[model samples]
Target chain A: MSAQDEGRPIQSSTPDGAAAIGRHAIRTEALSKDFTLHLQGGLRIPVLRDVDLAVAPGECVALAGPSGAGKSTLMRCLYGNYGAGSGHVWVRHDGRDVDITNADAREVRAVRRDTLGYVSQFLRVIPRVPTQQIVAEPLMARGVPREDAMAHAAALLSRLNLPATLHGLPPATFSGGEQQRVNLARGFAPGYPVLLLDEPTASLDAANRDVVVALIAEAKRAGTAIIGIFHDTEVRDRVADRLYEVAPLQDAA
Target chain B: MSALLTAEGLHLHFGKVAALDDVALEIHPGEVVAIVGESGSGKTTLLRVLAGMMAPQAGQVLYAGEDVHAMGEAARRRLMRSDWGFVHQNPRDGLRLRVSAGGNVGERLMAAGARHYGDIRAEATEWLKRVEIDPARIDDMPLQFSGGMQQRLQIARTLVTRPKLVFMDEPTGGLDVSVQARLLDLIRALVAELGLAVLIVTHDIAAARLLAHRMLVMRRGQVVEQGLTDRVLDDPQHPYTQLLVSSVLAA
Candidate 1:
């Protein structure tokens, strides 16, 4: 069904300016994604069924489930990393709404660049790039000046307790905890209102997990809306203002 | 009753940073000793050193009264192959992800040159059953399993070889509350049943209380406290140990 059919009005404001004042950051209705896994010669498997979710401004929602529950797939769909077979994803900005699901490749790229921040279970860091540069890339992509972005990145690293000397070094040499902090910093660098995280603290120890939890709380306080997939109970208990579980979509056989 | 592993004044250095300093520990047969500490407290380094994965700059590791560090490469390899099982904080590190559940569990036997396919498959099934994984899913890939199931599979893989000494680094680190409890119970039961000596490194005092007979608390690469688990956790002597106990208790 179309978003209008589901009673969601078409928003008229831009998402980039939506953060200044509180607004619904993510709205979805009847969202669905399907993947065909060829079994033998002519079989297909539907990975995700019709799903609906919504996140208001400054909300933190936790998604939980077993390995094949499609939690990650749902996050991918929300962040425009994957296309939905049917449904609408709306991110409201400045009283206007962007239909992320129906956007073309270039439009989706623009939406992801300006409005969405994502962190996956395994962090991907570029070789030879300083932590500052890595964290600043999102802001740079959003058209923030290089110097200002670097300053913002440095401030974030310091707040996260990353060593000053290591700021210019490659993230590969940092400890697992430090690298995760960098990934988080990059996700928040552009100040996007919507953040998507997948098992952010699964690889970290207790102390490091606490640090990331505190960061998530801080982000919410700063008015960022977060939707994350978590396997750690402590993290979900500590951070989730709301929680949902993704179950396997029934087969069409 | 014999000392299966011993460390004397173990010192490890990562560049200029001292990771372990004058550390000493001992593991005897059928005993479970837990090392408890905060992150960056050298607990993992100590375990790696004892497992012979890292060399100590000054100090000695003795395996059954022989200097393990001094052993020839072939002998050391043989000792590791026959006597030791090490579990990483992340099960993915301990498991072969691309392979099926059966292959992951059967590999240790295969590495030891157990070529009988029937025997390997039978042994893998037995181990999987031991770890509470359904035998019906033995052909599935590791990627298809849940977090707790993957960890159970890792345990099955490591224990299939029936090594005498098992070193587990945060075996329950990433599991959910109920899953962690179950996995801990499984480990405790299996350790008792097999009379396996375990040296587990963990930060959770509650887990240590449940699984360990003895406990060591480390800080800044030094062992601040070591004693029976109840004594150390109930009435910690060292300030660092006390802090750790209280922190976990508070949680």
Candidate 2:
């Protein structure tokens, strides 16, 4: 699916001049990204091209595509994890649209703190940190009092069906499914304006998957604009409002 | 908000090394701004220059619209004892070891022209209680106190004058982890309660996150990144900031 296949016409206007981000929580304009694999004989891998994606408040837009179709690449670009080779990734922050592609470090940091959030597939476990603290850190970083943050963390953990006994222990030795729950709890507790979840329930059981679906529904109801990559079609159908297909590039070096 | 203290085009050099390189900052009234970086990043040097202790080869520090470096020695000393307070990393550097805790707190009051002995002693006793030290220990010398107690006492002495701006250099540097935690909590509470404008320098990212509303991440004597505290710690943009955040033992 090219940029036009999504029913949005190609925009030739300056990507930085103005943005329609007041209504939409996030949007990209003619955004293109490529990676130059230096070790592989300077091979240029074009992952995404002329991508125009947008999500409105209280909506959940899921990225749909086959494996290696650049879905995750697009997700990363939206979150400012990957630099856009050309065009702008405009994110609404502090009541203005900021292009993360050209934004300075400070601007990007400000956008991420209150406006955007991302939950990677795997938990980046810090050695010796309790599971509850791991989940509570994002809240604490946002200036929430420690006690309140911990209480909120504990509440989210329990909602995910994580046993109370395991809350005090680190997730380093936990099963993949358990760690995924921890990651989900951490990402969801802060209640960001926009969120990105990549394969959020890949390792979860059917029961836990249902809990995740409910969480997504609640977030959407609370006015959170979410962009997620859900390989599980059933889970995707339950939560997604629409699908944005990312087609693979034909010119691969 | 108007800034309480502003430094512009700060530059300093030690032999061949640039300890402070064209650094600039603004701290508003009742706001906490922290300078954070690894050792030898020039955060401490920047603090000293801002406090009027060390004159930068270039740049000017303005406090309430007056140039800090342009003031005479005597006027600067007078300013330091009254409107400004500095908390050194070592308590001994900030306190008089021979003086009793009460006397140390009272000395600043006396310097500020509170000559009545009764009022000075009463205020000192109140401050001891505020810092969580027993009021009865007011007569004890700083040497008799533990490390954490000494640090608390140092804080009490500095804050006794109700300085409009306070400069802290690693206030929890040498303490145990538990002690550091307590000190941080106390600092946070006191800073909020008094609405004191603070410029704290620390290598501890967690401490900075807990106390400062804004932070400057320095590297090689330059401000590589700076922004809201949560933003810098969460999604660090500069490569040096990312390395610094990753180096910490995450809690």
- The candidate scoring highest on lDDT is 2
Indicate the worst ten consecutive residues by lDDT in candidate 1 chain B. B230-239
- State the DockQ, from 0 to 1, for candidate 1: 0.01
User: What are the chain A TM-scores of the candidates, in order?
Assistant: 0.83, 0.90
| Candidate 2 local lDDT, A80-195, one digit each (tens) | 76667788888888777877766754456557778898999978643556899889877876789999999999999999999899999989899999999999999999999999
Q: Candidate 2: give the clashing pairs.
A: none
Sliding window of 10 residues with minimal summed lDDT for model 2 chain A: A1-10
Q: Write the per-residue lDDT of candidate 1 for residues B1-251, one digit (tens) a residue.
A: 45789999999888877789888877888788999898999999999889888889999999989898888778878876678888888989999989999999888899877999999999999998998999999999998999999999999988888899999999999889878877886897688668799999998778887778777888878887766565456545455665576666433
Q: Model 1: C-alpha RMSD to truth?
A: 25.4
lDDT of 2 at B185: 70
Q: Give the lDDT of residue B13 in candidate 2.
A: 97
TM-score of each model, paired residue for residue = 0.49, 0.68
Clash number for model 2?
0
Tell me model 2's lDDT, rounded to 2 decimals: 0.85
**Predicted model with the maximum TM-score:** 2
